[model samples]
Target: MLQIQELVFDAWGRRFFDGASVSIPKDAKVGLVGRNGVGKSTLFKLILGQLTIGGGEIRLPKQARIGSVDQEHPATPVTLLDTVLEADVERARLLSDLETAPPERMGEIYDRLIEIDADRAPSRAAEILSGLGFSNADLARPMAEFSGGWRMRVALAAALFAEPDLLLLDEPTNYLDLEGALWLEARLRKYPHSAVIISHDREILNNSCDHILHLHDGKLDLYVGGYDSFETQRAEKLRLQEATRAKIEAQRAHMQAFVDRFRYKESKARQAQSRLKMIAKLPVISAVLREHTAPFLLPSPERPLAPPLLRLEGVSVGYGGPPILKNLNLRLDLDDRIGLLGVNGAGKSTFAKLVAGALEAESGEMVRSARLRAGWFHQHQIEALDPTDTPLDIIRRIMPEASEAQRRSRLAQFGLGVAKAETTVADLSGGERARLLLNLVAMEAPHLLILDEPTNHLDIDSRRALLDALNDYEGAVILITHDRSLMELVADRLWLAADGTIKPFEGDMEDYARYVVDRARAAARAPSQVAREEPPPPPRAEPPRKAKTPTGPARRRAEAAEAALARATEALAAIDQALLDPDVFAKDPAKAADLGRRREAAQARLAAAEAEWLEAAEAYEAVKEA
Candidate 1:
């Protein structure tokens, strides 16, 4: 068992923890809950011996191995697979001994290798990497090829592969996509090791954790069951406390009234003196104090929005290379609550950039209504703040004409009141900085709000606030996030950006999750192998969109591609009928083989025709718009 007894800690002269004690039994999965900057990470550091404890003791088994996910991973030429495999120090040492050990000592090395499962270590590491959304090709690739977020994934994969006795993960789902997050949750649920995870995602916390550790006001309260159960218990406790407080107040009021009415009376003076003595003997209820749980609701737009706030016509957006989002045609209406779906590098961010006007299309045209006012909130924006500046300083720079009071009031809506507003960004927690970034965007009074992974830094309460605000907002929202609960709550429509095209998705996150997993597993497979696994493309979430009517080449090409698709479909059906005769394979294997080849060729042809049809269909639509 791991135990923290009378743990006392402080930072910058502020006591974050005082006499806090909690015990995590062996194999217990604990969801560490607290507001941002409440010392969850600090406690982890204390356990890791990275921070000096002010008082008390943290006890762990002497043999316990602790593994923690590193926040930052350096860009190195190290192969992704090796990076994960290297996490097992014992395995590395055993393998090294094999190279230098004498012939007689080779037996000892071999025995140690068996103990450590050295032979399967690399393959085990690979399996963990694949579970975290890395493809087979990605395993051999150097870490330097990946972005910072992806490098963090590599770090997580390494920690998971380490398989320590005690695991500490801080917001493990923040860098993952929907499929990856779900996969990680499933893995962690079956993990034999004890874990303490700090996460804003309620689903993950509830699914992966068996216990809840409520850390607040420098105290730790351990609760049984999942996060929902903890909430239920905490709510009931507060309700009862409130009722007791009300009763105490009523009793005190009655007693005071009696004293005030009868204290000076001759005969009743004895009763008044007795009441004062009774009041002195009563226990204090401590005022039922609670940390603020009220949400910081965001303000609505300042001006009415015109319909079709943004439109994309044949937009091809990418870096200085081939387009990631090709010939994209989309429209953002006043009521659009589009949840954009895609993998990490699948142009979701590029699409957001196209809508936010942060990146111009490499080709084609994007038209925005003159009345369009867009609020763009991306994770990078939070990191872009000047750390030396206070919230007041930042807002003053954004709105110099507004008075100090006005600035503070505006910031207060997003939970930065007078005291918090004056706090320097350098002293603020990551979640606070994230909120300040949103507050800055809210001040723009945007007609369209485009948020990309907005809940990554927020606590559960703040995420709830954001979902409520988005639900009640008058303007449209273009949301790109892996928060399934938020997406399910906020999104009225879903836009799927897959296979270099964008279209309305008619299903929910559940359906999208299955699709993502299917896609990821098949990503490294050749088309023929994928065809064998899945004979046809998955069913569309919605009915097939109508083909646009166009003049000239686009129209002609679309028609020709559709005809080709029909022919390919017909030929495949014929091949299927021919192959259906079991007698054919029994009578002549040569004929069966010939039919199989024909079927394969037909499938290849049909796939090509389908691709051409989709391309031509997009072109036809683009031309019609032109």
Candidate 2:
């Protein structure tokens, strides 16, 4: 168990943790969450001993190992798989000692190696890397060959593979794609040791963690269950606190009224003194003051555009060289909310650029309305902001004709008040910059809005605010984000960028999640397999003649039953895949137990679907015979 008692930490010009205390039980998966700039990362630093506390104690078991991914692993000659394996210091030490130790002592080292299951370390490392979006062929490559982001993933994979007693992860999904994030959610759920994860992804917090450690008002409060449960519990707690405080205030007021009325009278002086004493003894309860999140301002377009605001026909686009995306045929309406999904290098950004008009198609026809206006907000815009420029300055350039007061008011509506309006971009928080750009792009009420990873810096509440704005906006949206919750809630249609082309995904987010997991599992098994390509859109055929298809309720019932059976079979297969892993139980018993429960549920669903399908089939056959 990790115990933090009366932790007091003072930082530059302010206190971060003031008498904050929380005890995390062993093997607990805790989600550490708070608003942006709330010192969540600072707490991790303190726990890691990078920062000293002002007062109080943080205790851990003796000789307990703590692991964190602070930065990208160094670029070296070591292979990716070997680098991860080296993270296990005990195993590495044992191997080194085996080289020099006497023959008799070698037996002990070998036994220890067997105990740790060191022989399976390579496969374990490869599996972790594959889950994080690494190709199997990349495992044997030198670390120096990979980029910084890939190296960061390697660092995270190393930490996870080590399985330290206390695992501290700070926004692990920031560097991952949606598929990688989903895989991580499953991986963290079954992690063997205790983990304190700092993440803003709601799905992971709700599905992967068993507890939430909320840091607010310089205090730590542990809540059972996930983020949703935390929100409900915290709300009720504040409500009760407010009620108790109101009651206390009323009693104090009543007693004070008596004292004020009778303090100087000769007959009631003693009674007044007693009343004053009673007032003093009343328990103090402070009123709960909830923090308000600034609202995101996304104005709707004044006039709606006709259907098919943008269209592409056999379009291909890229930089100056070979085309990155080819043979694209897609249509977007003024009201369409397109959620673009793909792995890191699956040409998602290329598609976004093509749609946003940043890059013209090299071949084929692209059509758009003559009056079409597109508001494009990409991550690079934030990175490209001038550090010395203030929000007021930015708005001034965009709204050159508007008065300074008008500019500031617009900023205020975008969540930047008077205080932050003049602050330089360098001094402003990431969330502030994100909000400024997001609102700025949509200020003109364009016909279509293309946002790429818009919620990377915003907190959960702010993300919700954005979601609300998007839902309210009358214009089209093409959202590219790693946040699954945002994607599922905001996008009405899903598009997959794969095999150098863009195409519609026929399934929802759940089906896509299963495909991603299955793909990763395949990669883990076959290290040399290439990226999967979309099957050639079944060769076009002449329109088929209308056949005597079955009709009536029985046919409809049969169709529904068949769909249910497909879903049930897929669910069961996913569970069976996990159970088939030989190392799952040995690595994470908790996950194994959870999988057992899920397997039973999947089995039950499968059986019900099968029975329903059989009955529906019989009914449909009878109707057809009639």
Candidate 3:
């Protein structure tokens, strides 16, 4: 059993875990969850004894072995299969000794090899690699040849082959395709050892773990069951906590009022004293307020966008090699909401790039409306931003005629306030840069929006906000994400891109999930698997995503519009507070004029933000229900 008692960790002047406690049974699988910066990874390091704890006791069986995926991979000429098989230290060491040892010790080395099951190590590593979407040819390839994403898969395979007593995996699926992710989840389930995982993928957490561990607000909580169970129970628990706090506050208010009224009166002094004592005896309940997620309010299309804004006929695109998506006929309109599903390396990103005009088809007709302005949010675009350029600089260059107010308004729309707008791109976090990129495209008022794995770097709150914003969008959207919740909430229809075919899927996300599971099972049971252990030539690119039934839009614009208004109102309120501050005005006798200038600038932006909300709402309401 693993026990964490009074675990207190302090770093960067913040108490991450203060007197927090949680215990896992001898062989329990735990899903550790928290906000992005909430120390989930830190906790793993603490358990591994790689970092010193501020205070606490972590008790583990002294004889138990631990294995984890490496965060960084050093460049190595070693083949991938050898790298994974080497994870079995005993086998590797014993085999090395056998090569140099005298004949007298031959029997001893053979005995050790037999004991450690060295003969099966290669096959085991091969099976794990194949499951992670690696071809047999990849097994002999040097580790340095693969990209960082594929390298992580090799890391996971090594960890799995190690077969530790306690396995720790942090975001294992972050780099994996859906097929690979599903394969990994099944392996973890069948794992005989204890495991602790940290992931934002809900399906993995739900399916792989029998217990969920949540760390938030400087505390740790362990709940029985999977991710779904944790969410449902946690929601109810929070609701009850809020209700309880409300009642306590009401009682406290009444008692305080009675005491305030009678405390100074001579006749009521005795009664007031008694009331004050009673208040002291009452249990205090701090407000159980849910932390707010980052605000992300996307703008609606103002232009009159026609249906079928983009059409691809017999289009085929890939990265230099043969086409991954071939002979495709697709049409997208302003009102269409599509979610793309596929395995990793299946060309979902390639398809999106083709649609966005970033990459031309090898040989096909591309028809697009003259007025088509597509807003694309892809990781590569975020990467392409000039590090030295500030948010204002980028916007100013793109829209040279835009005024100071217009530039600031556009930046603020994606949650970049005055300070962030002035900061350079190099200093921004991945999520912040993503928002900036999104704002840059949104300013163009695109008729079609394409998002490829937009939620990969975003937090849960930002993801929720993004989903809400996408649903409220009047323009067409093609979304490719691994987040099932986002797909379920935003995608009205499903499109499956697999086996070099792009076609509409005739089911929901749930059905698609079933299909994935079934496919995984079929692959696991396939014969001729042993033949795959040997090197095979490069094969066809993996298949991509699936589509779902469209959920007709309702008054979603109202919610998103309100969110936009709230953010605008908050920005205006900050300006008002700054303008009203005596300290700010007193900084110089001439500061009042400066303050007035700032206020005027802010008011113009506020007006623009308001105008956008009203216009979007009007357009949303005008859509006739068919």
Candidate 4:
């Protein structure tokens, strides 16, 4: 357990926190949330002792451990496992040294080894590494060989493997694939240690955290539950706070009027003075507004175009292989809100590029409607922005015909005020750049929008703004995003690119997720059939064991075969009953149908069991005759 008491942090002459106090209980999963530049990361550093607190104290229990993963990593030649295992190298070394020490020194060294080994065990290390989605092969690979994303995972694995009493993870899921992210969520849910994590992914926070900690304007705001609960509660609180502020202002006005009317009257003067004192003692309630403002805009003209805004006719695209996307024929309707989804390196981006006309298909035609107007936002939009251009200049450059007032209004709609619009694009943060790009794209009024990982570097509010704008836009959207919640919010259809094939999913994300889970479960159970096909284990070895009642082994074997046959028959019957259950049948028709077929197969298996039983019986009888 860790407690931060009256902690204050300041950076670059700006106060991030002023006497913010919070306690992280044992095994607590806490989400640190706030708008960008609100010092979530700075607070994390204070907890980890990386930065000195300006005032007050951060208390940790004696012998408490802490781990943190930052946004950057130092370049090192260490392997992934090497970096992780280094957490307890001293303990491991002590144990190793004790193993070879002389007998005369063994007693003292053995005690020391026990003391050191208690803090870290090899099994625990392996479990943490596996839980973080690092394979044995990955652990052996050099850290320098991995991408920045994988290196981030390496850092995360190191933190998790340390088994710290308190863990501070900063955007831990930023670079993870969907599967890795899910694995981390499950691991953190079951983690015995406490954690404070800052992440933009809503689903991760919702599924993993028990509490929400909102950092706003140098104040720590605590919420009882996860992200959704915090949002709902925070909204209500803001509403109430606004109402209270309004009432307080109204009372102050009435008091001022009474003072103005009664200041000259001696009898009323005392009452007026009392009212003044009361007003002075009253706590000033400054209403803290939500960071994001609702975007005000009329829906753009949605002129109906012909069907198939863009069509990929037998498109094949890849770098240097058979093809990452091979001979894919796909069509996008004007009303389609398609989400591009796949694992890393599965060509989701490549498919998006083909659709956007940014890259050419290797062997097939990418056709678009003659009237189609397209806007594309790539993942690296920040890098794509002109460094010399200010946000205002960029807008002017993109839309030469737009008046200054129109440009200012467009910028304001994306949360960029007049002052911020004057700031250079080079100086903006990743989230700001994303917002600017969104604003620029909105002004173009394209009939089709192609965004490749638009939510890549956006915070929660920026993502919400983008999603809202996209939802309200009447354009066909091809969105490639790793944010599952964002996809669910904006995507009306799912397109899965896997193993060089594009599969269309006609249902919502929940249904797609269920289908994926079922497939994964089916794959996991595939080996069960092979195990079942193998012969049973050999009879237990015995050195001429005395048979019960002097019975021969053959008779015992016949009884064992009959028992096995009866067990199989009973199992088949149970399966039949389960398949016929109305609730089960209704909830999952496919599972029920599969089970029904399995029942027929089980009947055949039962018949085979009976045949085997009869053969065993015959063989036993022959043995007895001999």
Best by lDDT: 2
Stretches of candidate 1 off by over 4 Å are: 101-117, 144-147, 244-283, 293-307, 311-313, 364-367, 515-626
Tell me the lDDT of model 3 at 445: 68
The TM-score of predicted model 4 comes to 0.74
Model 2 has an lDDT value of 0.87
- If the candidates were sorted by their lDDT against the true structure, best first, what order would they fall in? 2, 1, 3, 4
Report the C-alpha displacement of residue 195, candidate 1, in angstroms. Answer: 0.5
Superposed Cα deviation of residue 291, candidate 3 (Å)? 1.7
Measured against the true structure, the TM-scores of the candidates, in listed sequence, are 0.76, 0.84, 0.76, 0.74
Residue 459 miss distance in model 1 (angstroms) = 1.7
Pick the TM-score winner. 2
Task: Give the per-residue lDDT of model 2 (tens digit) for 1-626.
Answer: 79999999998899999999999999999999998988999999999999999999999999999999999999999999889999999999999999999999999999999999998887778778888888767888999999999999999999999999999999999889888899999889999999999999999999999999999989999999999999999988986787678668867887899899999999999999998889889888877877778887777778877656888889999998989999888888776788998888889988888887888899999998888888999888999999999999889999999998888888888889999999999999989999999998988889889999999899999998898778667788899999999999778678888778878887788888877777666666765663544232322231121332323346546767897999899888868877876656985699899999999999999999999999999988987785
Those runs of model 2 whose alpha carbons end farther than 4 Å from true positions after fitting are 529-626
lDDT, each prediction: 0.79, 0.87, 0.77, 0.72
How many residue-pair clashes does candidate 3 contain?
Answer: 12
Residue-by-residue lDDT tens digits, candidate 1, 1-626: 78999999978879988999988878999999988878888988999999999998999999899999867678899998888888898888778888988899999889888988887776667656665667667777899998888889888988888889999998899889865786777778888889899888988778789999999888899999888999999978876677677567667777989999999999999999999998887667756666664354545677766555777778898888888888777777765677887666667888888888788789887888887878889998877777789988888888889888888887887677778888988888788888878767866668888999998888898888777667556677888887888887777677876677677775677776666545544543432233211222342453322342213345546766887899899889868977876767986799899999999999999999999999999988887786
Better model by lDDT: candidate 1 vs candidate 2: 2
Backbone-clash count (model 2): 0
TM-score, cand. 3: 0.76
lDDT for each residue of candidate 3 in 105-136, tens digit (9 for 90 to 100): 98999998898778777766777877787766
